[model samples]
Target: MPILSYLVGKTRKLGLGATRSTTYYEPAHIAREFATLDHLSKGRAAWNIVTSMNDSEGRLFGKDKHLEHDLRYDRADEFVEVALKLWNSWDKDALKLDRESGVLADPGLIRSVQHQGEWFKVEGPLNIPRTPQGRPVLIQAGSSGRGRRFGARWAEAIFTIHPHLVAMRAFRDDVRTQVEQQGRDADSCKVLTAVMPFIGGSEAEARAKRDRHNALARPELGLVTLASQLNVDLSPFALSATLAEVAESPLIHAAAAEKLLMQGPETTLEQLGRIFASSVRVPQLVGTGAQVADQLAELFEQGGCDGFVISPAYLPGSFTEFVESVIPHLQRKGLFRTAYEGSTLREHLGLADLPG
Candidate 1:
């Protein structure tokens, strides 16, 4: 938070991720902190609401076990409710800076949140004044059914992972349906899928580069990461065994696991390990600048996604290549912006300003 005050001055938007834990925080704390950050950023703050998938994270929070996936989302639903109430406690014109009359605020313009819910008991108006954007943008990423419902209710933006264009389109359409069902504009929520791009001089070069990256991957790290993400002990399974054998693991997210297995029914643990060790099952876009741009545009135009969250395989190398190569092609095709369209992230994302 101390750093955020200064950070808001440096960047146009900042997203803070949070998880549900018994010992760490409450709705009121999150409400106040993000509200303060929104004020500091002049409406540039975003809250990336997350349910911690790493089972070991519970240990750090003094819990014997992680909360069940569905239950976690249930709690998050209420948590967001309290935060929204606190954020909306004050009107935009609540603050009237009149020096001559020594009047700083209109008392009638602000009110207590007075929220009492299943997951939280937040009392009154936040200590901080209303922010420029009114409140921080809400982001949620949950591919599971319960997770999707929670996101549909409140999330302004959603982060997703789908390895196939067909699946991506389906997910996007489903989310918009969910949004409309909630009495909100379908366009209000933007869906961004994760993409790992391998940009090179040509298609063959990109493939060769990807193969080299795959060769350097460590399967042991993949096992640990998969265990944490799925909340299951995959060590007991043989590396040669098919994913179908372990698909029913109670700890796993059934929907996500099925999707992975469908990619290759005979997919061995080692094969899956190699695929995941390098990338967490996101679709890999491997090609030269124009070819990659064509693929991205196709997906975007087909309603596969609103945008993408590019997860580079290597830091400066991968990002540098994309910016110098792919970005220009996308801009030339009129599929991407060549310059900053707005000052605030909300404006850039085409989100409506918060209600005053």
Candidate 2:
């Protein structure tokens, strides 16, 4: 966060991925860290709300097992409420730094949070001053029903993974509907899809790059990863065994674990293994700059997403290629920014600015 502070005025936003873990650190600590970062960045910090998925994470935190998915999110909802009360503890006009007055701040303007809930018991105003944005932006990336409800109530933005346009559009609409049902403006929460793009000068070049990358992918590593995510070892079963043979795991993200079953009864564990091995879970665009731009524009125009979190299939090289090629095409269509117009992340994302 301190490192990101230096880039505050240079158009950078710090996104801290905070998993729910009251056993390791209290919610108050999470609130203070992000609050401090938000202050230092002058309102450019965001919290990527998450529930740690793996048993490995639980072990590292001194837990015998990870909490059930629904229970974890249950805790998250209360945790966020406490953090918000703390953030809003100080009124907007609480700060009174005046040379003429004998006081540095007005004590009466600040109030105790006094948050007592199922998961946390936080009291009083946070020691740090209020952030420039009043509160750091809340970001969420959970695709499950329970996760979506939590995001609707608290997240200012949501990150999602959808393999098709229809599903993506439906997901966006559903989330917005949920937001309205929660008595918040439907447009207040922005939905961003994670798209892995492999852009090249031409279509053939892109395919070749993807093929090369795939050939080097290790299926065993993918199984290991899937096991960690599902909290069930895939090694015990044969590659040809169907998902129905596996008993439901106690401590897994139920929605994510059920995804393999949704694929169909004929899909072998081997096929699913390859899918994860090659990172084919999220939708991928492998094409020329113009082709990639057209797809992105189509998705954006059709209300499929507010924006896309483009994850390059390969680091630096893929990123450099896209910036030099695809971004220019997007800029030409007026679908992307040609130059940044704001010093803060929220403003860049078309969010309202705080009053001075």
Candidate 3:
């Protein structure tokens, strides 16, 4: 799969972190920087559209609090719409370099996005022309109902985490339905689950490592985050109590807690505690490279996903290992890229180039 990396920072306000930001990175700068990167990567880069939701971040901008998830997505929707217009404002031939008369661009091919949306009104004729792919691929990480709807309408890739097979399959199906409901081909968008690995030479070692990491997680922060994510009050439940009863709570009901219990009967209240705190029952694929990759393959084969979003405990070097070890195995099985086959992200996604 073609990779999408951030140039500056994240809009951590949505649900993952804070609330929302009033101001920060301008569209023009991000468009230009990302365009140049796409040019360099030869059209294998994507844009992760985000708007910060940190209430503290809002306060940084002299606000009392952050906006809700719905409002944040609304603003980000307008922001990305404007960004797309800025990208398309220049036709591929606008830079018709003619050394004969010293002409560089055709005036007719250049245009502006006189965008006036509910949250953002941007008057822009982007500084940089079009990026290599006509548009930088759009990816969304939100998984809440409203977030899923927003992403299905606009996102080419939906970044999410789900632990239970039942929940993931149901969500994948529902999101696809939403895409169709929005007049888009459900298959046009792809689902990528974040697989945070805790690799070791053996299953026992890997399990130990996973336990260590889980233990390190902050409970208070996790509960706060979980409460916000599930739109439920988590304060009522005691950490020591098994979620056996919190099952009735909308936050935990029909969700992955039950599934996790089914998967690992020995899983303790503390483990369930973490899931509640994190507010996501993403099956943390903790195992050796082979075991992890095999699980990923199983998920892909079952149509639970098109691929994995390997979120390593380590950063750059960790991904390098993933690409070298797991990626090669996946490729040998005809599951991943051996070389660049397309010149653009859309092409990588099997999408047609946009009209002039």
Off by over 4 Å in 1: 1-6, 12-24, 247-265
Best by lDDT: 1
- What TM-score, to 2 decimals, does candidate 2 have? 0.91
Q: Summarize candidate 3's per-residue lDDT along 114-167 as a digit string, tens digits.
A: 987676677778877676677667777776677887888888887778775666
Error of 2 at 176 (Å): 0.9
Instruction: Please say which candidate is ahead in TM-score: 2 or 3.
Output: 2
Cα RMSDs, all models: 2.7, 2.8, 6.6
- Cα lDDT over the full model 2: 0.78
Worst 10 residues of 2 by lDDT: 14-23
lDDT (Cα, tens digit) per residue for candidate 1, span 29-148: 877887777766666777788877765888878888888778888888888777778888888898999999999999899987787777777788887788777877788888889889
TM-score, one value per model:
0.91, 0.91, 0.76
TM-score for candidate 1, please give it.
0.91
- Candidate rank order under lDDT: 1, 2, 3
